[model samples]
Target: MRAFAAAAIGLTAAVALVLTVTAIGPPQDGTSPEPLLTTVPGPKK
Candidate 1:
């Protein structure tokens, strides 16, 4: 009985998480506008 209750609680939590994510939907801002890192020129040999 204890195992069954635990399994039920886990299943409920998983379903709730999936529903919440679906409701939130995708992000609107999209990708970053600038490059991740800047490059610097190397000293001449």
Candidate 2:
């Protein structure tokens, strides 16, 4: 049925995504090299 086909497609996509991310693994460093902006800047004079 169409519902079954859709479910299979979703499952396959999810598995592929998990495998890809697993292979890539996490970053070596705990933190990022570039600093992340946390606050908005004030208006310039």
Give per-residue CA lDDT, model 2, range 1-45, as digits (tens): 999999999999999999999999998878867988899988999
Measured by TM-score, how close is model 1 to the native structure? Answer: 0.63
Question: Global lDDT for candidate 1?
Answer: 0.93
lDDT of each: 0.93, 0.94
Instruction: Determine which window of 10 residues in candidate 2 has minimal summed lDDT.
Output: 27-36
User: Who wins the lDDT comparison?
Assistant: 2
Q: Estimated TM-score per prediction? A: 0.63, 0.63
Clash count of each predicted structure: 0, 0
lDDT tens digits, residues 1-45, model 1? 999999999999999999999999989889888887577868889
